[model samples]
Target: MRIAILDVDYRSNVARAACVTAPSWATELPLATHVSDIESVQEYEPGAFYKRELPCLLRVLEQLAAKPDVIVIDGYVWLDGACRPGLGAHLYQALGNATPVVGVAKTAFHGAETCPAVVQVRRGTSARPLFVTAVGVDLAEAAGWVRGMAGLHRIPSLLAAVDQLSRSTFETPPGASAANAVAG
Candidate 1:
């Protein structure tokens, strides 16, 4: 099965999508293609941090034109907006059952329990912990894969590469400073 691991870039309109492969028996999440796009995610209220993320979500979903059987999304769907169940659920509705969708988040939900297959853990350089709430794809599969292919480094391999790629896409540094870009 062809799998794409997705992650969002806070600095730009692009989201990262890469092919996930197991290079060794124990490791998975080897990423490639690592494309980025400008999408519309304004569905969330302006005050919401993810309001601007709508564009990336749309652009990321459009990549599904290739019709990979499974799409592993970057954030766990929760709250009212952005890419959580609202967007993920909406997207799944648009794609129908023909395509299976899964959400993974760095932050967990306090008000709700969880669906089957989602996992939680800390990611990124700061290692600042957040709950990962995913709905579309099976995280049991993703975590086992993530255990190997990446470092505790600030950015996930796929997301890090995608962040770099999106900056290059516009020929810009992503922000006033590279540091700002990554931090954003």
Candidate 2:
């Protein structure tokens, strides 16, 4: 199966989205990478974080050469048991609910323990656990996959790569940074 991991970073008025894809069997390195920059991005708003991120993510996904079976985001799918939607959830719906989404968050969300679709995962011997949530996949199964991702630290290797790729936009010519780059 092909899986894609996505992350976004904002600097000044630009928002950059980075996506890295690899076969599930080959987790050590990404098979392909894509990044897009959205200029004049909306300013951050208190309770509406998804508003800015969702569009940026969609723009990045639109530039993908192929669609992945599952897309992973750097946040929670649901904030509470009541199913409050986060960026991942909105992305899942915006994609017409065809592709499954998994969210991996570095920090715990308040009241997240009450959510049946949320799971806490610990990698290595670190006391801190990652908060994982999913849409269109079982929570335990998603967590298990995360546990298998390449990494010796708390964050998986590919995820960290994507994060770096997103932030590296600042070093590249306005929109030409990741267009010719492939991780594998």
Candidate 3:
């Protein structure tokens, strides 16, 4: 199976999205996985997951019950106005090709020119850029897959749902405790 997984922080809840694909079938997500990076909200502050991403990602990777052929991660956060993390380079460094991984974002990052081809999506009549990377799957192949499935929208179906879900997850309070990130 050609599987792709998406991991992102939502209200400090680490939301995961998975899609399994084959020659004839494609399966996407069992809803989402919500994870918290800190052991307690009293110890860490809200939005800590997005701020301290390495710890957050460690928790997220642990929460993944099933492995995917490729994992796509969100890649942007700032320590200061001028010091933002490189989502693509960081994810690549973290994974080290041990497993295929890619970073996704709406905005462009510095050094993005070195990455794979970026998707120029124009669903029907609108023209806009979409995603970038050639981490696990080929860029053209991945783009074709999204173009076939993204429907009449600027964003792909899976990513659009994730974006909305992440925004909505923040509406609810993340509560009092953190997740035990140790692998089971």
Candidate 4:
């Protein structure tokens, strides 16, 4: 399956979104990579973090040549068992709920342990667990895919690549078209 791992980073007024695609969960290297820069991103809100992030993610996703079978994000899908929508959930809705989203958060949300939507996964002997949440896929299956991802550390390789890509310096100048900024 073609799985896309996505991440975003902000610098000054610009937000950079990066996507890394792999054929399988255990692949160490990406089959392709894409980056898009969004200017004047919205300010981060306390409980509405998705407002600042979802647009950037959607813009970057547009750069993909084909829709991914599944998407992995760097945050929660549901904030709690009540199914309070987070970034991933908002993304699922925005896509018409056609794509499955798996959220692998580095830190736990408050009361995440008891949340039915959340699954805590320990990897690579690290005491700190990855807080996993999902929509449109089995939580246990998502956790297994994450646990099987190619990496020696707690964070999977593709996730690390996307993170680094989002934060990396873009060669295209500010105000340049997204076409100039995207790289595969």
Candidates in order, TM-scores: namely 0.53, 0.91, 0.57, 0.95
What lDDT tens digits, residue by residue, belong to model 1 across residues 69-182? 655555544443243454445545666646555554555554433434345445544654433444445646555444333655534565444444444443333332211122
Best by lDDT: 4
Off by over 4 Å in 4: 175-177, 180-184
Give the per-residue Cα lDDT of candidate 1 at 112.
30
Backbone clashes for every candidate come to 20, 0, 1, 0
User: What stretches of model 3 exceed 4 Å from their correct place?
Assistant: 2-4, 7-34, 37-51, 75-85, 109-117, 170-175, 178-184
RMSD to true structure for each model, in Å: 7.4, 2.2, 7.0, 1.5
TM-score attained by model 1:
0.53
Q: What would the per-residue lDDT of candidate 4 be over residues 80-112, giving only the tens digit for each residue?
A: 879999999999999999999999999888899
Q: What ranges in model 1 sit over 4 Å off?
A: 7-55, 60-65, 79-84, 108-118, 122-130, 136-139, 152-155, 167-184
Candidate order by lDDT, decreasing, is 4, 2, 1, 3
Task: Give a tens-digit lDDT track for model 3, residues 1-184.
Answer: 3333344443333332222222211333333444443333222354444434554454545555565555555543222223343444455456665555544455554444344345543454556555545455566665565556444666555555444433443332445444432221
TM-score of model number 4: 0.95
Tell me which of candidates 2 and 4 scores higher on TM-score: 4
Model 4 deviation from the true structure expressed as Cα RMSD, one decimal place: 1.5
State which candidate has the highest TM-score: 4
Question: Ranking by TM-score, best first?
Answer: 4, 2, 3, 1
Is 1 or 3 the stronger prediction by lDDT? 1
Which structure is stronger by TM-score: 1 or 3?
Answer: 3
